[model samples]
Target chain A: MTVKLYDLAHSRAGDKGNTLTLSLIPYNADDYELLRVRVTAEAVRHHLRDIVAGEVTRYELPNLPALQFVCQQALTGGVTTSLTMDTHGKSLSYALLEMKIER
Target chain B: MNERIRIGCGAGFSGDRLEPALVLLQQANLDYLVLECLAERTIALAQKRKRQNPPLGYDPLLERRIELLLPDLIARNVRLITNMGAANPLAAAEKICGIARRLNLSITVAAITGDDVFHLLSGDEKALETGQPLTASGPLVSANAYLGADAILPALATKANIIITGRVADPSLFLTPLMHEFGWLPDNADQMGQGTVIGHLLECAGQLTGGYFADPGMDVPGRKNVPDLAHLGHPFADILPDGTATFGKVAGTGGLLTLATAKEQLLYEVMDPSRYLTPDVVADFTQVRLEEVGPNQVRVSGGRGQAAPGTLKVSVGYDAGFVGEGEISYAGSKAVGRAQLAGAIIQERLRDRFPDLRVDYIGSTSVHRTSFGEYPDPYEIRLRVAGKASTASMAALVGEEVEALYTNGPAGGGGARKYVHELVGIVSTLMDRRTITPQLTLFQS
Candidate 1:
């Protein structure tokens, strides 16, 4: 079944320079392995291709049942120079959560 | 039972809430109260202020924060630590001492310096991301290294009532006290890593206490989905000698402390779980764990660390020209068309002056920029155009062009606004730790 990533996890976004890092922590601990298998770096890159100008990297944390994705060149010119109202990419987490995941 | 001490966070940033800090000082039996007030670009702005007038480069709210919490801190015997010093720790320390004297309170203040490396560094230093040399990046404003707890330990040894620092790592503000109290050495990576986790969690004050974790109808039980943020309580930690800690908020204060909140904060700004770099030690957050021990309380432990990095990260700020922004709103039937027309009109008007001017339709693609599904023809739209220029006056022209659209192009356009300001460009580089020496100056009242 297709379900939104938000239904399975919660995320928080933070940025440094042009890289936007999103932390995806599963709502249920048991879903960690499933998410680890389904949510690939390529999947995130494909989902955010419109915004991300650089590559996407994902780091796993089985202990926290979470995944951390660093989307490079995601912030137009980052905090100091980005003209976007949401300079820190704080809303990007919601965009990532909107991605469809197979349940 | 292991020996433990309580540490409370007063203010997270330069402009954080002051009343909650006062509450922590008056109510919590805290041994130390750390207020982290410096951000990446804050020191650069402070340096700009200092250039205009020396001794004015500290946190603007420093005096107000001191006035509000001074008496309570003294009464509770809580020593204070902060990077509120910004670009001038000595001046900030002197001001604090002066305030203590006015209140007839005797105290010792220690100011830690030597974070500024602008003069020491060669102009050819390469930026981490762009690989562009510093000399090629216009006039420099400030270059401060992220110093570690080593500098702070000496100030703590002096037994100062308040320790003011410039450009120390955020986590070091909390980690230094734990190391001092527990006699944790510099090479104790595991303990330092554990302490770093606690420091990182508490560094943002209310972030781990449901302030930033709240989302309606979401989040798990024991986690407050709808938080009371009006009187948001700052975070405090009860740390054992072994580096395990329990996080909680002050009693009768608004905010929730839960395992979920702790987990959210754990990964904040963290790039890699296996190698979180800081001046003190490279902490590994992958092994960390958070458990809800009781109501509004969570026990956090299991942070492992590796050897400290030989080089420290430096934030170099340069004059990046000026930015001018202008916005105008259009509503009614053809709002989207009107806004788009207004944006094009401004772009045409400022094409010669600001060839790189950028335009955004607020209701359409202001944030995600066509990333999200297309917005249906909206009832209202805000047209915004912003650009960078060599001088303030040139930047101001971009905004002026947008304001002209109200009368010249778009019908029903209103709420036109414009602004021009200087921009500070930040570039990160690393410096060998051995080159920068941290020194402490003492002031007595």
Candidate 2:
């Protein structure tokens, strides 16, 4: 069965310079392994291809059962010089969550 | 000294609420209150304000905050640490002392200066990311190093009623007190790591207490109907000498401080949990555990880390250019079509002047940039156009062209608003930690 990433996980985003950091934690702890298996750096880059211009690095924390993605060139420019209404890219987490995933 | 130091973060950012902070002060019975009111771009903007008026570089809200909190703060005896000083800590400290004097209270305030290392920056220093020279953007306005708890400890040792600093790490403002209260040397990596975890979790103030965690779902319950959001109390932590910390909000105050909220805030802005770099320690956030001990109470512990980085991050601000923005609302039938046509017309009209002009349909395809495939049609859409230009007048062209859509191109466009702002650009670089020195100044009322 297919499901929206939002159904399985919750996330928040933060920015520093041109990079955006998004941390995703599953609502159900048992789904951590499934998310880790499916949500790859390449998959995320493909999912957020419109927003992320450069590299997207993913880090895993088994203890917290969370996945953190650091996407470079994600902010267009940093807070100082971005033309977007959401200058800090606070809405990027929802954008990432909009992606579809197979359950 | 107490076995556990109680600390509360009053303000998350510069413009955060005042009521919640008063709640923490009056009810939480905190030993220390930290207000992290500075962002990367704030100091650069504050530097310009200081240049215009020498004694006016501090946060404009400094007087109001101190004035509002001074009497209560003195009566409660909770020491305050804040980076609300922005570009000028000395002036901010004097301003707080002045506020204390006006409140008919006796207090000592200490200001930590020397974060502004603009003079030390050579023109050729490259930004940390692209390795491109920072001055390549434009002439430098301000460059401040991210000072750590070390910069603040000397001032914290003075037992001042308030301590103000400029351009320190948000976590450092909280960590300094822990270091001072616990007498933990900066070299104590484990304690520094554990304390940094607590600081990071609490740094965003209300975010730790469910201000930003409001999505109620089938799986995640009891979040959407966060009771009395208007009175949502901020958070405080009680950390023991053993490195375990329990976070809770004031009893009877609105907002939840459950494990879910703590888990969300645990990794809010952090990138690599294993190598979370700060001036003090390379904090390992990966091992930290968040468990709900009781209602609105979460126990946090088991954090680890390594040594501090030899280099400190420097936020360099330069005049990038200006950004002009215009937004107009379209309503009723065929609104999306009119907004689409409006966008095309402005894009074509400003093609020569603003080659990189951006158009966004607010009700639909605004934030995500692309709508995956095709999004649902909307009954109304707000058309926004924006672009960057070398000069303010040049940037103003974007908004002006968008407003021209009222009669020139599209039909039924209303509620148009235009803005032109000189954009402040911030880039990061690293400097040898040994080169930067933090100095402290004291003011008494």
Candidate 3:
């Protein structure tokens, strides 16, 4: 089954004003080649409380083949229920009901 | 349905010591029972079991323990679950079923599987270690993916008397069954947050709500009683329907579960608070708020969270450096302070002897003392030195300093000591967004 789950705040917002940022690199590039993608100020405003701004100014690295979303904040419990929260900090009960998991 | 349900966890870090935490559950009078014991090294031990002629996995310690307590739990009708099935959960089910038949107890044993992702990486063994597109390891000893609570939900639905799993997320032990009974699901982040809070509070048994809290007014012992020799208390948490949870020790148990104690356990072995990722959920520790609601009860709530990514990251530690620990005490005027100085001296000597050696201390003396960064300590200092590098003989070198403490320091009676040898390995693993899909399994025995 296919369901749409929200990517983490910064991941969905992309690189912009928010502290969380994403980077891209050539498939065969070394770890150092990782390049940061700059998000628009508008995108930053969208992810303010969700994340903080990085100290250094970052360059935007666009995706050529496919758009990638990198979650800066942690999330888990794809589906479970509990008065207890999962390790990722999200509650399984809320996550399962809200998360559209095709099973 | 909204009424409070008391869940008791069985099995602890140690099985040979402390009167078996499982037995205490009977006296505590709990509603549900959980047994937890899954460590990185335990996986290696489970591998050894699978390598045997019969290919048996880890022992069914919980099932055996349950055999003794089955009458009590059945009398009270306490449903139970555990992650004791380290590698071969199917085999574990067979053992549990054997015991159930002997006792004539109608027990529904559910085995949750499919999280053994390591086996899938066999053809491409290298991809398993680095988790990189392509990389490898020395040998495929053992591999078990950390499953989430949702996987256990199906098992709980079977109306099983006991749910057994392998390498489930730590908090999932407490969260899954609670969710199954309450009918809560993914959309319940707030409730999940509450459950996460409960798991965090009870993660270390009695640490929260008073086991570790040194409340002077409570007449509790210092470090000696942290793992109390006398009657250890069974800690309980009361979770409200409104997404708040309160925790404390079982009435007359020895330890205390105060705010201080609870806070200490919250930060244990944790790397980040914002995305407190467990095998089950990504709990936010940044906004967690704890208050001493009563003498021994701490109300824990207010842990906000973000949506988890579609992928789950795995960590595998590889060869990195050597870690050796040696302790020498100076029993003079500035005993503690001098021990600290000697620790520094030995560290410096090791570093000087092998400039590349990375040295550091553990226990109360180190910065990374507690599991998480939640608690602070004002205790006497204990020193440990770690060396990381290709050229560092950390173990043999550190051993020399342990011998030097008596002669180098002021006339403090320093004696010979032994060093625990530990190998430092680099933990590296990756998350496959595609493989991140959640699975639910329920088996009948």
Candidate 4:
């Protein structure tokens, strides 16, 4: 069955300079391998093309069963200089959650 | 039973609530309390103030925080480690000593300085952004290096009841107490890694407790949500000599401590899970494990590391000129069309002068530009217009233009507001650790 990523996983967003990093974790740790294959860096780059201006790189944490995504040029010009209302891109994680993947 | 050091974090940032910290200090039976009050741009902004008016660059909230916590710290004999010093550690330390005297208490305070390297910059150093010279950012306001736990070692050795610092890494404040209490050598990679992991966990204080966790009650099935955040208490750790620790908060407090929260926090603001670099050590969080031993109790283990990095990261703040903004509220029928028309007018009016002007629809597309699912039009919409310019007067035009919308006939635009303020730009660079020296100045009441 197919379900929204938000139903299968939860995420958090963080920033350093113009780079925005988001952590994606499955609600069930046992769903790690299944979600890992479905949520690819290429898929996220395509998913967030409207917001992300640069490349997206994914790193895996097997122990925590979480995925960390490093998105480039995401904040426009960092916090103090960004023109966006969401300066830190805090809600970008929710945007990622909108993706639909295999359950 | 293994000897354990009890540590708690009071303030995660400069303007955090005093109540949660008070709760931790009074009830947690903590041996040490850390208040991480410095952000990336805080010290840079503070340094700018110090240059304009000497000795006035410390944290504005430092006095109130110290005034409230000093007695408890002295009475409970709980040592304080904080980076509230901002740009001037010595001045901050002196101010704390003054407060202690007025409170009729005898306490030793020390300040860790030398994070400011603005005067030492050659101007030819490359900025981390575009490989351009650091001076390209214009007359820089401040440049302070992110100091490691080693920089704080001398202050801890002074046996001071309170240690104030400027521009130290957030995790270093929590890591120093562990280093001192356990006699963990600076070069002990494994031990330093473990301490750093715990430090990272507890550094944000309330974040570990559900301050930033996702909300509950979504239509999506099966999300175990965070509860009792209204009176949420900060997190504290019971650390063993071998770098093992059990993290928990005060009993009868609001908040949940579970494997889910820990997993989310484990990668919060983290770019790489394995190579988590800090000034203290090259912490590796990949092998780390978390287990909920009991209700509101989680045991965190398996944090490893390598040698510390050779260079220290520096936050350089520069004057980014001024930003002028204006907001107008539109309610009732046809609010959406009116707000969009107002935004278009403002954008058109300033198109020649401020090409980078921005307009946002507050009630609708302000936060997320694209909606995930289906959504209906709202009854109310607030239109916001903002633009940046080199001069304050130039920036103010953005607000004036927006305010003119009322008379200019956007039709029923109410509650108009206008404002203009200066802005700061931040960039980072790296300097050899050997070049920067940390010095501790002592004070007594």
Query: What are the lDDT figures for the candidates, one per model?
Result: 0.88, 0.88, 0.50, 0.88
Best by TM-score: 2
Cα lDDT tens digits, model 2, A4-94, are 8888888889988888999888877899899998998899999999999989999998887889999999987777787777889998988
Stretches > 4 Å off in candidate 2: B216-225
- Model 3 scores a C-alpha lDDT of 0.50
B4: Cα error in model 4, Å: 0.8
Which TM-score value belongs to model 2? 0.98
- Interface C-alpha RMSD per candidate, 1 decimal: 1.9, 1.7, 19.4, 1.3
**Per-model TM against the reference:** 0.97, 0.98, 0.60, 0.97
Please provide, for model 1 over A1-103, each residue's C-alpha lDDT reduced to its tens digit, 9 standing for 90 to 100. 9988878888889889889999998878999998999999999999898889999999998888789999999998788777777888988887888788787
Scoring each candidate complex against the real one, what DockQ results? 0.64, 0.71, 0.02, 0.75
- Considering every candidate listed, which one attains the maximal DockQ? 4
Query: What residue runs in model 4 are displaced by over 4 Å at the alpha carbon?
Result: B220-224
The residue-by-residue lDDT of candidate 4 on A1-103, one tens digit each, is 8888877788889888899999999878898898799999998988888778899999999898899999999887888787778988888888888888876
What is residue B178's positional error in candidate 4, in angstroms?
Answer: 1.3
Per-residue lDDT tens digits for candidate 3, residues B1-445, read 5666666654444252234354556566677766666655554456456667343675536565657766666787887777777776767776777777788766667777765665455334334323443224333444556667767887766777777777666787888756875776756676676677677556556444344333233222342234352556656666655557777566655666654455546654343445667655677765667776877677777765555445554433223334444555445355556666776677667776545433323333232122222235433334444443333464566656666666875356354554534332222244553674444444443
**Model 2: DockQ against the native?**
0.71
TM-score of predicted chain A against the true chain A, for each candidate: 0.97, 0.97, 0.21, 0.95
Query: Please, what's the RMSD in Å of model 3?
Result: 14.6
Task: Give the Å error, residue B382, model 1.
Answer: 1.2
Candidate 2, after superposition: displacement of residue A5 in Å? 1.5
